[model samples]
Target: MSINFEALDLRAFLAVAEAGSFRAAADALALSQPALSRRIQRLEGLVGGPLLERTTRRVALTALGRELMPLVRRLLDEADSGLFGLRGAAGRGARVTLACVPTAAFYFLPAVIARFTEQLPEVRFRILDLSATEGLDAVSRGEADFGINFLGASDAAVSFDPLLEDPFVLACRRDHPLAAQARVDWADLQPYRLVTVGRESGNRILLETALARENVRMRWFYEVTHLSTSLGLVEAGLGVSVLPRLATPQGEHPIIVTRPITPRVTRTIGIVARRGRPLAPAAQRFRELLIETWADKVLADKVSVDRPRP
Candidate 1:
């Protein structure tokens, strides 16, 4: 049979059942005797059985009430335990840890981290800056809460949530022949020496994978393992490097500029967390903030590029 008693009713019944004196129970519950009686009466109505035998001097539990007492106590105990766990899990002093590729760690996450820390001053972060492959491994192995990386090969151990599409751009010195153009094609960049990341880099893999789909390949005169090195080479008039628009600095650079590649190629960046596993409250909050920050960045970049030039 289904019972409709509230927790308050259960508590009130338990209080009176234990004390065996309505007056004493009332005092313990900080309730008037009549109010306590009313609560027991409501509980009886829902339980469809009288739970207490009350008299002028003594109170006792009926057989049904005695049978239910242990069950009620266990329920209360479990409820308290659950609430205690929830409170501790979301506490302000908790540490949030996650992983992401170096490119994201460098260009995207710092601003998001600054804003998140402002909201949760006591929260600590253990941000693992690794390659996309390593980031995925960290989350899968439970070493990290989650990761951010370009969308590529599926994994049964991890899940991805696409946040934004980062397009490849041509990074070149301001004085380069094609730097003045708003956009340049892959073929246009072929005439000049090209700098690219090493094959070990996830960025390089993503670029090569994209180019292979179109049956296109470019000769790389200079190959570097770091984006900073690629930028340095571009600044020194070595050659232009193709990179995600997000990798380039937001504002004007005195010597180097990034122009979008024509027939725009892009990579999908997203969140990767362990399959069927939920993140801690702090990690979840940081994930939401990252999404909001990315959305703001996308809008701001669109406005900056679309606004009328003076």
Candidate 2:
């Protein structure tokens, strides 16, 4: 049967079912008992079924009532979510929470954030520096609006969209022998002590997997938490480390040289958001800014100038 339902009446039904008495439901709904009873009666007439088995002492759902309750609850929940989403969209000036890998924060996020601030001065940002796994978790848990992480071929409860691919480079002291080479292979790295990021880091994992494929091994001198720390160790001639090209600071350091690794390896960086969930307006605006900045400043410049004029 075709039935038109009012949200207020549905709310009344839910309250009666939960409170188990018309008086209690009316009190909870902030309506008189007679008004509440009239709402329930109107709803029951529309559905053409006795929803609740009511008596002088108690109230309980009939078989049809039990069947209809779940659908009514779902309808109310969807309506509430829709209203909340619309309100959030209307309040476009709200702050956005973004989580990202530390390296992305250091090397990639700054320029995007600067551009975003210039355009959307009224918008606020809350940034969290987390590892790839932690960043993914934050997005999945609804703690972050979006996350920047290293992309890989794995199925998780979040949606990932590749933004850029940054190649790996070998960083070492300027005086080190390998620094002078035009290009170095994995085997050439075997002699030097490696000051690497922790194995759990996405960068380290990619590097290790590539090295394993080539059957190349190096002496592990140290493991550090931050890329800057590893760069510092490499600059001090403590060891050489493989780092993303973007993470390598520009200009000459007193003791550091950066070189491309032959048979180049790269990591995919991407934007991650909760799967099957809509993004808030602020978050969507921030994401657009991120992509625009990356495309214009980072990816566009990195393209080869020698390629046939396209």
Candidate 3:
């Protein structure tokens, strides 16, 4: 004869074994007394012996039941732990973790994140506001599911997907001479003392590389650690600054204005992920949202720039 048992049988037996009375066990398990009895009977049948000794007012375990008690308790304990572990893993997956450059985090990513979260109210986000190189490292080191940053030299462990080209633009005080022009060339900036980000910044490296290739040079009178800080300097009539178009203030800042530069140079931003690794469902969904929204924004920017201004 073969012996078989189900989780329900073990659970019922454990509940009855621990509660000390059928009525108490039935109440605890949220089952009728008769149903609880039936479950114990099924387990007893498989065991081929009486497991519980029932009296008019109390219940006691047989010798066989005592032997099986510890084993059944261990099995149930392990099962519960495994189920809880799986639940924890699922909870972690419900949130998307993305590493993004400060430029994207400031101007491009927030709107897309708002739209993505609206459709997934249960989903959450952990945004790592890192620099281009740091963002790349986050994804490559498995600290983030994906990253949005410039197309820099990446390791063999990661792959890149081009997203958008953010061109460098000139930012100046509203009443400055360059603000009235439709566009100013790099050569046109020669006369101005420029406020630029420090050499430590990836933006500075990009500017240096592009300028070296174009064979252009400019005098940098003030250096700041952050692009936003450069804007303040420009606003105070210190000097003009060249920064990514995305870094420019979006709304009308009466003290500041931005203009495109001739012989435009752009930094290509992209998505970075560990090679051959798949994104969690939430991360993949957010990635799709980023791509779609980016397309709309690029088109809109082009249309706005092409429109004739009064």
The local lDDT score (0 to 100) that residue 54 gets in candidate 2 is: 94
User: What is the lDDT for 150 in model 3?
Assistant: 77
Instruction: List clashing residue pairs in candidate 3.
Output: none
RMSD of 2: 14.9
- Give the CA lDDT, 0 to 100, for residue 251 in model 1: 97
Off by over 4 Å in 3: 1-93, 153-155, 296-310
lDDT at 282, model 2: 68
Model 1 has a clash total of 0
Candidate 1 lDDT, 241-286, residue by residue in tens: 9988777877989999888887778877777778778888888898
Ranking by TM-score: 1, 3, 2
Question: Which ten residues in a row are the worst by lDDT in model 2?
Answer: 301-310
Tens-digit lDDT string for candidate 2 (61-142):
9999999999999999999999987865644577888888877877677777787777666678888888777887888889
Candidate 3: RMSD to truth: 11.1
Better structure of 2 and 3 per TM-score: 3
| Regions of model 1 farther than 4 Å from truth | 1-85, 151-153, 292-310
RMSD of 1: 9.2
The top-ranked prediction according to lDDT is 3
Superposition TM-score, candidate 3 onto the true structure: 0.65
